[model samples]
Target: QDNRISIWSVGDLGNVGLNGEYQGEPQLLCDIRHNGDVMDMQFLDQERIVVASSTGDVTIFRHHQNNQTLSANQRWEKAHYHVDRQASCGGAACTGVICNNPEIVTVGEDGRINFFRADQKGAMRTIDNADSSTLHAVTFLRTTEILTVNSIGQLKIWDLRQQRNEPSQILSLTGDRVPLHCVDRHPNQQHIVATGGQDGMLSIWDIRQGTMPVSLLNAHEAEMWEVHFHPSDPDHLFTCSEDGSLWHWDTSTNVSEKPSFLHQGGRSSTYFSHNTINQSVVSAWLSNDPTKDRMEITNLIPNQTLSVNSLDVLGPCLVYGTDAEAIYVNRHLFA
Candidate 1:
């Protein structure tokens, strides 16, 4: 953890701090308070973090851990059109963002998803209405295909292959109605994704299978704001919620209990982003696969006021923030 730094953002404030270090007290190396609340963020690399804001802006911050300096650069100002509050959809507001080098994708309340290339002046292509309700998050499954969750907990898969502007497949998070707040796919097994939401429900989904969750459970007292699969450990999951809690979910123990991998030769596949229509690119293990047991969860933070809105998992360490304007550091979350 020598050169590692931790970053977190919530509401209007964001901070970058030295990781695994605190002699007497913890302190921020850089603090950024944006014009509006921060909605979503992703680390581009060791130096840059991409951020999306409620005010429709997507910005990038470059960090220098050696000097503890942070600088900001505007990527896209007024990235989406927030609808007028009077009309009901709470006026368009940006919700989340993800960066995959040459391209960056940002989603928002107005159901807009704009695709920007790092060198381009404006969006290369824009799905003006990706959904009817607010788009909470967007992720690249194969780069050519993307997944989005809306306020209604509806998951839509868009195949960039066609010139048309509609999703190839749409599914619901649950039979009962509950809004979804966040979604994260497995770092290695792209089709396996996790979702957390308004009802505090945590659901594991294998997009290739049927629409229903393989397993679902109440993960938090309040809304589960973020659900992430460890980058290095696929079996472990990390979640933080509005109940002001941070959790370490260790499914590593269950790895040995898992059924054997799906039989191959039963199927074959090929893939990319925005190029070929559905199947030529998007492929799944198969339908009717059995569900595994629920994961083992540890509450790293027992309790707190307001929501733990942001978090990031780094090896055996973790960092998360709460709506109370507080950030927590767990130097040995796994150890």
Candidate 2:
């Protein structure tokens, strides 16, 4: 609520025990006051970060690693705003931001989508009425395609290549409208996507298939705030919720190749071949047989009593922030 951006170093989280516990606090590196409430932030590159604000503005900040400080680099003011005729237009909160290198995409409460380049002051493309309801989150399906989740529990795929403002495809949950809060795409499979809703349910979708999600797993007890797929290991997933819990989902056991590993002594050893593994190693998200799909869900933070608002996974480390005004880092996630 203070509207400040702080940086910390979690590089020295130390080793994990056999039972998967680690000790070490993240060291504070720097803090900078932001112009408005920070809604979302993403690392644009090694030295820069792009931030979305409640004031409907997007700002870029450069990290001066040598001095452990940050400085504002560029700003795009009023990128999103309410369209009003009688009253003066008001800024609508920029709810989410995603980075695709030089290109940045932002979604807002105004139901607008803006695309901006890192070095440019103006938006390259703007989709004014991308949805009637507020857009909550977005993820890239491909370089030219992005999927956005909105307050009405609908997911729409927008093709950046097309000049048309309308989405190419739309998917939604059945029954009552439950706002989706966050979304993430599979690291290895562009067709697979995951979204967490206000109902605390996790929905897995195969965009290549029908309009409905393939699986809806009962997850957190309260609103799920964020969901992320491990960048290097797609089989592992992470989610945080307003229930004050963080979950690690392991879907490796659902892969059909588990049975083939037992017959390594015979010609079945050929199953280890790259071509064979690639063909057989289907993501559990696409599994049709629900009964055989085994997924292990572990609560990473069982004692935390405040909402975990955001989380990110890189290599074997997981870092998350909470409503208690704290950040936690867990290292050696595979252990």
Candidate 3:
């Protein structure tokens, strides 16, 4: 719980064996003290990093590659806060932050969304009341559009080009509002989005279609913490949960090609209508025929039961952090 941002260089993982374990310790690059509890962080670029805090402040830090030290660059103080009868209360936590090179977007418990440029000290645009509840996470659907998940299981889409502060569209879960915790968009298909909720269910949505999600897959046993699509291979998905499990979902196999007798005459219909979707271009996530829609799931951590808080997958590497104050790296993900 010590609010600190530490950087480490995981030396060449090429030596990691087929077992996927790396016995060597990561080399400490630098450690910097943060203003408040670090809520989220992202690399602004190779030389800079952006951090969001519980104090509702967002700061950019410069990492000196040669000296291996960090220096504060730009700071946006009190970017989010609760207003009561014209008085601003203690700053609300900036829960999520995303970077799009020069542009930075932050969402907070105060239900505010702030947009900033790396060179500017002030927010370029502010959506004062983006949501009535806390915004948990955000991701860019397109260069000009962003999607945000809130405390009440609602996903709202905002268009940056619009002068209006209101969201362009809203989508939500069917029943009791299970707070959504994390979200990630498909690397290859911008229209496909995945969200994880407090109920541990994984919902896949085609933002171009109806308001409801296309598929709701039963996943973790406890609150699902994070979900990510492999940066290079969109067919591979990763999810970590409070139940202390990290799962790898593989949809690479051609399960859709297998003929199914479930459809007697016409095209097969599954959880969602795929009649219009071209099989060759359609994502396996939108597979028709429930009988043939099979996804192989592998639990990465089966023994430990402490919460797996966050995870990221890039190429053949998979790294995750846990509530037990440990970070695990699996280098041979594809093997």
Candidate 2 per-residue lDDT over residues 8-95, each given as its tens digit: 8765545556655556555789989997789999999999999999988899999999999999999998888897523444788999
Candidate 1 weakest ten by summed lDDT: 278-287
Clash pairs (backbone) in predicted model 2: none
Evaluated against the true structure, the overall lDDT of model 3 is 0.84
After TM-score superposition, the amount by which residue 121's alpha carbon in candidate 2 deviates from its true location, in angstroms, is 1.1
Q: Comparing candidate 1 with candidate 3, which one achieves the higher TM-score?
A: 3
Ranking by TM-score: 3, 2, 1
TM-score per candidate, chains pooled? 0.78, 0.89, 0.91
- For candidate 3, report its TM-score: 0.91
Tens digits of per-residue lDDT for model 3, 1-335: 56778888888965676588876788889988898888888898999999999988899999999999988899998888887423455788899999999999999999999999999977999999999999999999888999999999999999999999999999999899999999999876777899998999999887876787877888999999899998877778899999999999888677556442223136554333333322323467765332145678899889979999888777788889898987888888988
- Residue by residue across 207-226, what tens digits does model 1's lDDT show? 77557675576668888888
Best by TM-score: 3
Q: Which ranges of candidate 2 are over 4 A from the true structure?
A: 13-22, 84-89, 258-280, 289-293
